[model samples]
Target: MKELNFFKCKQVIENNNIHIWLINLEIYKKEINNLKAILNSDELSKSEAFYYRSDQERFIVGRAILRIVLSYYLDILPKDIVFYYNHYGKPYILTNTIDSLEFNITHSNEMLAIAIANRSVGIDIEYMYCGRNLEEYMESLFTTYLQKDLRMNTSEEKQKILLRLWTVLESYVKATGKGIRYPLSTDIRNIVNQHTKNLINSNFEISIDTCFLFKKIEIKDYICTCCILEPLDKFIIFRDEFILELPYYFEKIVR
Candidate 1:
């Protein structure tokens, strides 16, 4: 990953490509005030409503960074970015012109990720190294929904596979514009065997349709999945560690 310093926040998008930004939420500790300043009223209210301070910080930083990153692509001020939600509560940018930009956000532990693509996309990350708690999560959250093929290996291996499966499934549903509001037990069987045949063999690819493809991202100690509306092999994965900086326009006084 290359470290870049620039005059203004900038991001580039390519045809049929997705850019995944891995952001370290801990950096928000010192810049919390500056981060909060960039958020809109709605975002600020949502951040302030978090019960835990850590959650609040994450919300503020996450939403603030989301706006900042999105602004570059939209050629708008971060504070001017507008969002509207779908019937299933999936958020979309409100634009006068037809926009193909699509994005998804997911956070695990202190790490947050934002995926931007020109087509439908969804992303999820899971921290499965939570000691014995992972076992409890598997039993309580995933055991019953486990597909026949995913029920392999010992306890530890099973938990890892379950987390991977969970991320893939969740990302798939999110990509389809249905968030967790959709029950997993009823929807779990929707994934075709041929689509997830690579999953059981420890290969990560979930075929949503002829055009949509899913792949697992290899992040140390974290399970992440991304679903995009393009052939997986056609696009190359570019990894970059994002460092949040206040946009230059935010520093200028608007007369």
Candidate 2:
């Protein structure tokens, strides 16, 4: 009876699902100056350290956007939110108003993805541009995603498949806060093999604490993966009346 109840409880959590906010950086370019002021001195210095102008802008914009998203739930000014880093260098914010809330961020080029859930979560997105040398790119992929016979798929199709797989691998490390030290050489091909047919509901093992779910989000020309530490059977993309400006405020989601 207890075990059955555990599954039932998980089902309830799944019904609530993950909340993701997709930020399109291009739309916010005109507000860069406004976003710049949202950063604290520490973040300003870090942003300045980036060599490229574009890189600096991304750091500032990404930080500001993350805070704005959190501000909605916290019912606070975005600039007042304080962030602390865990041992693995993942950033987290604390709010006495909310409990059991966890979030993660990932960005590639102009697209930024933020995922929030009731459990530890990590999110990753990759713009699928054909800039990588096919040979070198496939070398990094696990054997399970690679074809034994080179004739299995067209070059374009293969790149999409392998690149999508890459995001899943990345989501694991990010979700774990394992950082750069985690083995990038891990061949998830075999582990992911059993779960590929149902990408959104995929679950494979890395360890007891690694992940309870691996999910794919559909965004054209980009591959996105989200990993959650606790099983959630469903997810929702949050764009209901969202604005790139300051948060519109929201009720506290977690208790």
Candidate 3:
């Protein structure tokens, strides 16, 4: 997999653009104390509620990293950021200080991905080589989708196609704030299948109606996908590397 470089400074988000942070949680282990301290009471309590120590640590680091990242953007203290969740359990910033700051988070195996944008955004990252029998597992989960989308591929190719489809479905539902509740089989079959066919291009991006746009990203050994609730031409996307050190070292922009 291509590892994202973590520098020493914080990143700034621009208007009409999406900024993605690819964080490796392992690097934040030593800063557990600092990160934990930055979590608000509710967040801290949620972290403590995790049954496993590792889970608790991941939650703390993830939430804390979110706070620190948002702080850099909003220019507020990390501990001051408040969050509210929608009915589908999508978290949103609750403060009045920043307007239209929307984001989504997804983590897998030690890698955490965050998408920040002015409009609604969703991201999903999955370990491509996870030990699970993807062929069998995906067949069971996405039987109808596979039948419609992967009619021509070999069994091996089908697995790769299936993973891409899964990420697309996941990120789409998440971006719409419906989560998995949106019946994958009935609700989005037409739009999903169309995007699946479009993924044949090396760089594929399409708007499902005027409300949402879906795109697949090429990250080694990982199926990373993103959805933005706007037409593709309306916004720009910036992929920023993670910074491990707890704050301060703003340098030149990567652009």
Candidate 4:
């Protein structure tokens, strides 16, 4: 994993065609001020600026991590990377460069992660103890088959397993840039298998070429998944170490 010094922050990882940027939100003091400047700028509408600024600190961390990771692939300044929202409201790259780097950003609690790859890629991370009744939430958010699978795997050993599945599904939807347009009620196994096969057969098609590779990573207490439209021989997972620095910042800022 390659660590970058861009933006004066540490703990950025890059391998093969993939880049993962992580940030522990607790450590950054200047982030809030920086985000406020962006929000207060005349470039954004009053309502839009106010909405984003309301959660400015979190979004600042997310965008900072995104800028650093993307800088490794694009020559543009981190703040200059223009973004456009898709029909489904997901943000996407709008550069004229031929790099074709696909990426996704996500944040939960104090941990924020971003993934960038040569093909369409999406990633997600959720805290293990987010105060949800797992069984009840699954029944409402997942398909009948998935609910049954969760029920059958009643052993305590499956908490991580359930999270793994959830992350993968979330990642797939994010990669497609569809968000919840493709609901979680769809069969998980079928989606993975079918998407992989479809990508292989339609590699020459423009749409398929936009998203062709997919992967998932599971770390202690965290589950993350990546989806791409291109084929991949193997994936290398790197658990970012920078999250350890966040608590220091949080202690100073939030308190």
Best model number under TM-score: 3
TM-scores for every candidate against the unseen true structure: 0.79, 0.77, 0.80, 0.65
lDDT of 4 by residue, 1-255 (tens): 223234323322233456555556555534445533433233334334545543555665556556645654576556677767888878778666554667788877677777766666788887776644455543465456555655665444346555555666677778778875434445444553334323223121212334444454444565666666665543544334432233322111110
Task: Give the lowest summed-lDDT range of ten residues in model 2.
Answer: 1-10
Q: Write the per-residue lDDT of candidate 3 for residues 162-187, one digit (tens) a residue.
A: 77767877888888888875234564
Q: Write the residue-wise lDDT of candidate 2 on 76-118 in tens digits.
A: 6778889999988998887787665678999898888899887
Query: Highest lDDT, which number?
Result: 3
> What's the CA RMSD of model 2 in angstroms?
9.5
Residue pairs with colliding backbones in model 3 are none
Once fitted onto the true fold, the runs of candidate 3 whose alpha carbons sit more than 4 angstroms away are 1-12, 132-156, 232-242, 246-255
Candidate 1 weakest lDDT stretch, 10 residues: 246-255
* CA lDDT scores, all candidates in order: 0.69, 0.66, 0.70, 0.54
Between 1 and 3, whose lDDT is larger?
A: 3
Clashes in predicted model 3: 0
**Cand. 1 Cα-lDDT:** 0.69
